[model samples]
Target: MATPAHLNRVALRGRGARSNATGRFETYRSESFDDGWTEADEAARPLTTIIQPMKSRTIIARNDSPDIGFNASINPYRGCEHGCIYCYARPAHAYLGLSPGLDFESRLFFKPEAGRLLERELSKPGYKPQVIHIGGDTDPYQPQEKSLRVTRAVIETLARFSHPFTIITKSALITRDLDVLGPLGKAGLVRAAVSVTTLDRKLARSMEPRAATPERRIDAIRQLAAAGVPVTVMFAPSIPSLNDHEMEAVLQRAAEAGATSAGYVALRLPLEIGDLFQHWLRTDHPDRAKRVMSLVRQMRGGAVNNSEWGQRMTGEGPVAEVMNQRFLIARRKSGLDAPSQRMDVGSFKVPARAGDQLTLF
Candidate 1:
């Protein structure tokens, strides 16, 4: 099969994805290599990931699909730095005329005006409060967040408005914002989910190169729960024959760490993700690639992915069914679904506008 040209490069230096394959927007191709380079010199060459900032007029992205739970979501960054191999958001990079492979990881874009835009949106007339999902497309707390803090700014705006919201991330960096989240949690306006794909550190290191380790995520869960924040453990993109077997163990750990609720998403490979994932499996776990793909195809109903709304997350078929059952059993046994902590939208206060006189209802 003709796939993305693999970039034979070292795994270090914050680089992850397998290739910088041409995206859907591009009509031409671009390739780079040394003219007089020998195989030996390739190993010693140095490369670095680049960050490009972009201004976004809008901060909230609205979604109406029944499969999704939130009406509005905020993506502080366009591409994720965590570099998860099975990320469904990878294909979105194509829209920016960039590759959905390595470029999705190395070439990043953060919206610096997210907080201002969010405040402006919230100030709109008749704006109804709903729990806005943060990091719906990319990890808001991705490595870039350490300096950018756009996600933090957005959270600050939400907190000021007493807006209801939820955060989803696999980075322990979220712990840095516990001061803000703690107050919001106490106000019943916030909750969070930590995506823990697998407990195997080695597999996690290979698949989600820059994400928080499994243990640290669990620790983050513990910290959040201790701070009175509702922590939902998300076992996302559970790859069959790879890390699916650890579903119970992972949930158990989360529950022990005080996660009150849990959720799981069967691996979703849409568009270029299928090819990129296949290539990743071949390079990292060659022996299991064929079996994993076979099982994924079966779950996807003979295709690499099924875009139908409801089926996209959990998937359908025997393999998917078994995995779903396993997750449910683990959830209940772990007491993760005991009682859902609901965020309050009724208390939502409209944010302050640039120039407005205060009025009481």
Candidate 2:
């Protein structure tokens, strides 16, 4: 399928989405008109990322999805800058009245008071500590995090309260917090998961434009494991006929690098994500796009997506089963098939807040 002319705008370098269509909630639609003179200037200039602080009353978000591993998660940022074209979280940007395409990656929001909000929540009388996942929707350590340190602050708060937490990220920036994570990891209070989609440099650069390279992710697993942090390598969104062939290789490399656990999630194309990913595939990999979508549909039951609870994470059908078996066998061979490390919930305790009466111990 050829990309529609209106949606075939030149993809900006370092950005994943080729077009910035309007959000689904908007009533008006905007398109570009070529007067024949400005296209050159537009192509010459690069798009810049804009970030604004978001005022939020709460920090911890609780979800009761049975398939999800954790009941609560904290995202320090609203939008991710890594610009992974197949990110399942893209649809969330629509709720913000922004396009799930380019706007989901370039225009971002951060919660400057995440640490304070979390502390207040933890200090509450009825608050109960559970395994908290970081970066469940968007990457907590996206590029902006290097300077903002919002994720660092959240980690600090969790550590201070002796809460058990797990973090999933594709950025190597998580290594900078080894000072905190290393100790918490030793106490069984923290674990980490790194998503490594493909080993091919070119493919990773195209699909997850701004995330860490495959080598760096593997190295991150090594670093985390070395620091006593239990590391799990997530081979997520395993696209058919594209990066699927490298599943075994990626897992083998991660295990060699010291990853003790591993997991995978089939590609998900829900809502606006279906169109955005299709656009990216048609524009970047037109040659194999048809075959790719065909395999995806086969797994998705004749559609590009199947959001059913039991099947959304790993799809269904013969192809999906084959992928699952392959992952199981490969993980067994690589010694990553062991049960995952359990976080220590028993050690959780709320730290004393300032201005509170001192204990008479």
- Which numbered prediction scores highest in lDDT against the true structure? 2
Residue 149's lDDT in candidate 1: 96
Candidate 2 residue-wise lDDT, 36-118, digit = tens: 55655554567778999999999999998988798899999988999999998888898899988888999999999999999
Residue by residue across 1-361, what tens digits does model 1's lDDT show? 2332223444334455666668977889664444554465554554456897897888889988899778889999988878898888999998988989878888889888888999899988888888899989899899889998999999999998999899999999999999999888888999899999899999999999889999999999999989889999999888899999999999999999989899999999889898888988898899999999999999999999999988999989999999989988889899887877667888887756568887797
Query: What root-mean-square deviation over C-alphas does model 2 reach?
Result: 1.9
What TM-score, to 2 decimals, does candidate 1 have?
0.94
Clashes of 2: 0
- Ten-residue region with minimum lDDT total, candidate 1: 1-10
Q: Rate the local accuracy (lDDT) of all candidates.
A: 0.86, 0.90
Best by TM-score: 2
Clashing residue pair totals per candidate (backbone < 3 A) = 1, 0
Q: TM-score each candidate.
A: 0.94, 0.96
- lDDT minimum window of 10 residues, candidate 2: 1-10
